[model samples]
Target: PEEQFEPDPSKKNLVILGTGWGAVSLIKKLDTENYNVIVISPRNYFLFTPLLPSCTTGTVEHRSIMEPIRSITRHKQAAVKYYEAEATKIDPERKVIMMDDNSDVKGTANKTEVPYDMLVVSVGAENATFGIPGVKEHSCFLKEIGDAQQIRKKIMDCVETATFKGQSPEEVERLLHMVVVGGGPTGVEFAGELQDFFDQDIKKWIPEISDKFKVTLIEALPNVLPMFSKQLIDYTESTFKEEKITIMTKTAVKKVTDKTVEAEATGPDGKKTVEVMPYGLLVWATGNAVRPVVKDLMSQIPAQKDSRRGLAVNEYLVVQGTKDIWATGDCAVAGYAPTAQVASQEGAFLARLFNTMAKSEAIESQIHELSSTLNLKPGNPGEIATAIEAHEKQLRRIKDIKPFHYTHQGSMAYIGSERAVADVSWLNGNFATGGGLTYLFWRSAYLSMCFSTRNRVLVVVDWLKSKAFGRDVSRE
Candidate 1:
């Protein structure tokens, strides 16, 4: 017989899955006095994802931007339970979740059953490949800290190998050519950082490579940074041209193979041409794909038919066709853009609403007991209905929790060491893009948002070291 794990009956168990922006924000705001909270995620720390591009070039250390879950949990009223595990199945009927401790996806290893009174699923999205060949096998990703480290190692490897004792020009060119797919903020930012490194450090130390070292950014769309305003987008394109970074717009990668990538592009003659370009390092930033576990959960629900993104949720962030189970962030289609800002806001909102519902329930119970003990006015229909209606109104309010909406706090992207793009709002319907002064503001803003004082200091140190001595070129 399997181990029978029982729910903690001492307190209401609230289990939240995922450690992304949404889960972290929710855990931070929830009043732990109302329940026993449990956070389950594969990652033990919450990552500040916006500044990840700098990490690849060692401009910012990975640890400086990561905050441990324990630190945030300690802020709660009660001792919150944390399980570094993946939730495989959510059995709403049994009020239990099937989770496993094995690294990656579990196969033969036994799974554990943990019951919960309330569940929040914020397990985020995965890298979306869109069935494009050669992507999973050859390209590197930029979604995690490990990915950054790998890219850094690859950069060093590219520079070292190309400049090796007696390598041919063709081989060196191939080795130095870094190809980045998808022209979103991530790809653009990464390419910008890579170019900066080559211009500032590699050129100074390893001059033999010359201008053969190139970075190419490919976007299927007509322009890069589609989410930004026209002014900012134009600014980025102009900056890329000035920086000599290749922008291959209107080009879609059909297949990525080791040594070369096969792509189709429309030419100036309105005809299509197939091109193959040899590359050294490839970064795939084609947004996110659905993780297997999330897909399995969505498949179980029929109402999730129209919900191709992820689990469909009601206004309360509750997964449709279930009760006492809620989800947020990228994992579920919360009817908002899958961004760090949106996810965090949804999590915090859920926390506040959860606190109110709990208090309302307690008050309702007290009123019921008082009415029964007093035994007064059994014929008062208005009082009875009104009493029931008031709390019922509370329940409706909880149910009527509005669907998540994304708040655009403006857009900012790091183009190089001292340049950035900001599509921000100003007074009286004014918006502008000024690189010089805006660059400083961007640096200061990100520095202020670091996880802690220690993180702030560490990031500052990385920046100063990079500015003074230049980046460390050692691969290891």
Candidate 2:
């Protein structure tokens, strides 16, 4: 039988929040034996969010991209404790985290506090609605697994409801219209996937609503994918035109009702016009908003008051105005875009930093013990002196850790119909390309980025299954 794992009282309690890309990456590479590692998050699984849009259209199964937190922790050298709960507050002064078990099932003690010598805040952001009226109630977000499932169910529901007996032409049009807001990667990828579902399967299966089914992508910006090069952007726009997906640029959604979306569109002449469009499924994917916990923690730090996006962090990823707290991912203003690539890099950096710190401390302890022994003995000092000098030299080397630096890995997004756009960083130069080959690259890149071997296998299987049998359109 396996030995029971216990926390070492002598070691520092390192608490990590969230199971997203950043936190999971840190945990995966961290030297858990050096600290009493404790992970706390509402989610018990680490979700591969880039592939999340695929889940919406059943291109990939939700579970296929989800790697359980336990599966990751169980392989660590030392036992890591995981709490399936939400961290409500962080008391910097007391070094304690107030957490609540927000899940349906609970024991006698649901609310508690966990003290930590070091804290890492990597809780990802939430969907940004921009205070748009009726958006929270009407629109579906593509953030989590549940959101994808909701979208998958709503798509079929709308189709079945539209094809019902004696359905009005106007109502049928409304039910078949899928409106996607935001021109970012999330919105663009989802819109492409949704369109693919209709073009490849829905149109073939339900010919009655073939022409009526349409996808309209709404972006407040002048064009979608602002991060990409102009050439790639034009290629994406032209590709969307060929795919028959309507691209409404320079249009900001002002309000949304249960069945209609009201937006203000700016013309080339700079004149703005309010247009109301009916839709069955409305996906709001503009961007991310700061989570409440992160906001509250930022409020406690005077240095973070001016930080609008998230908790301001120094080059070392340490939260400003705090010595022991560090922030990463979407919840951190680390002079980088809140992309998975950035988060994972930051997490790995932190792991290296902490491991080096632990080594430095151990060396310091050894030097202190050796010096004390020399002081007491006062006889054998030659070997002890050499040993202390060697330890000091090694400590200096280990302590000279550099600041965190992010490497731009380029960006890729699927634009549907077996095509994709990529602005790749290759050989110290930018290489922008878009087409079917880029789509294959996108697929391979995402597959390689999957959390675990199991995830990669499952995702490949899902893709093959979907391609062979079409998406499981059955509403659940």
Candidate 3:
């Protein structure tokens, strides 16, 4: 439809933002022959975020769980055009998005405005810092593959510094202490993986510094894993206790300095007292926040005033403020939790809708042939038959064009080696949460979810190697 590049002038221009679960699902589901699909995001690859925690300990290499956007749309119905750039702003009136390729180490500057007949925003959330001072500067976020790599390096750096003979005892103690805030799935999982690495690898190679290393998990709530049932939460606490890892609950982190975290907690006598804990490394997995680009888009529309989190959307996943634009995942307050399942479902639904709209004439052509079979005798046959036949056929194909519905498959998290907790309903009835064997189930499930068979085989090999000769202890 555009001036320069229209292989087919009849094809509608469909632009999708972000390569997260939702956007990818949308791209996969759309019947591409009817529309020119373009995907734009800062990241070029789709991250299997659930297995991301394991990457911090080198158990799962970052590349294993990552699938290039081009690979996903490869065998799909339509080959989606991918742009490695971030959408800066949305001009609703002009039906255009301003995007710029983020360049630092990578030298690529293909920034341009992309016009769209239909738009989908699945821009995911960023790690929330909550305006906490020094957190952004000092804390390591576990949202992306790069963040996991930095954490791996920082963990080794702390160990190396702590064992250096010339350093002071106080400095060494700080270096040996690993502190994690927010006892959510990510925080708890990270703490578990770190301890696994130290126990399995670091303890054997550098036995001299083994006893000095410690891990502490702090949560502002009274108990960790709030999403799980009471028994599961208790089980996790007991497991952590047995592993000798510290679990501090009801602890509020006030601020974070270079090597210490200032916090406040209530005493046994019901008195609040401030405490400072020294740390070698701090991981702030306190969940997500709306990105600045999303905020700017939200502020532009008056109908989006009540939607503080991001753009509000109707059941059809269409943005409430505008007719053509739709939003999915964390960027939209879609009456669904910001989870991968919901995002993926929304994407699939959008694809079906676009496909149906594109092939409606085909369906009408099918209906026109059956028009003679109708027993209704009427003077205005053409007008009556058009409405009557469309309604009858729509009933049969309702599933192909209905609004999005999310099916919660429950949650699963790996605590440590041969240890996990799952709240699954697919098997074991409803609300099945346990550790030990369940951890194996978690591992196998995630391994099977790998983007490619190549990644799956490599991951299986890594696990087997670790089992045969312990973990790789080399810092580099």
Top candidate on lDDT is 2
Clashing pairs in 2: none
- TM-score of structure candidate 3: 0.90
Off-target runs (Cα >4 Å) in candidate 3 are: 1-7, 105-110, 268-270, 361-400
Best model number under TM-score: 2
Alpha carbon lDDT of residue 120, candidate 1?
A: 89
Tens digits of per-residue lDDT, candidate 2, 1-476, equal 22246889999999999999999999999999999999999999999999999999898999999999998999898989999999999999999999999999999999999999999999989999989999999999999999999999999999999999999999999999999999999999999999999999888889999889989999999999999999989998998898899999999999999999999999999999999999999999999999999999989999998999999999999999999999999999998998999999999999999999999999999999999999998898998999999999999999999999999989999999999999999999989999999999999999999988999999999999999999887888
The deviation in Å at residue 102 for candidate 1 is 3.3
TM-score of each: 0.90, 0.99, 0.90
User: For candidate 2, what is the TM-score?
Assistant: 0.99
Backbone clash numbers for all candidates listed: 4, 0, 0
Write down the RMSD of all candidates, one decimal each. 4.3, 0.9, 4.0
User: Is 1 or 2 the stronger prediction by lDDT?
Assistant: 2
- Candidate 3 per-residue lDDT, tens place, 274-359, comes to 99999999999888899888888878888888887777899888888789999888888888878787888888888888777767
Q: Against the true structure, candidate 3 has what lDDT?
A: 0.83
Estimate candidate 2's RMSD in Å. Answer: 0.9
What lDDT does the true structure give each of the candidates? 0.84, 0.95, 0.83
Which stretch of 10 consecutive residues in model 1 shows the poorest summed lDDT? 1-10
Native-to-model Cα distance after best TM-score fit, residue 427 in candidate 3, in Å:
6.1
lDDT, candidate 1, at 126? 91
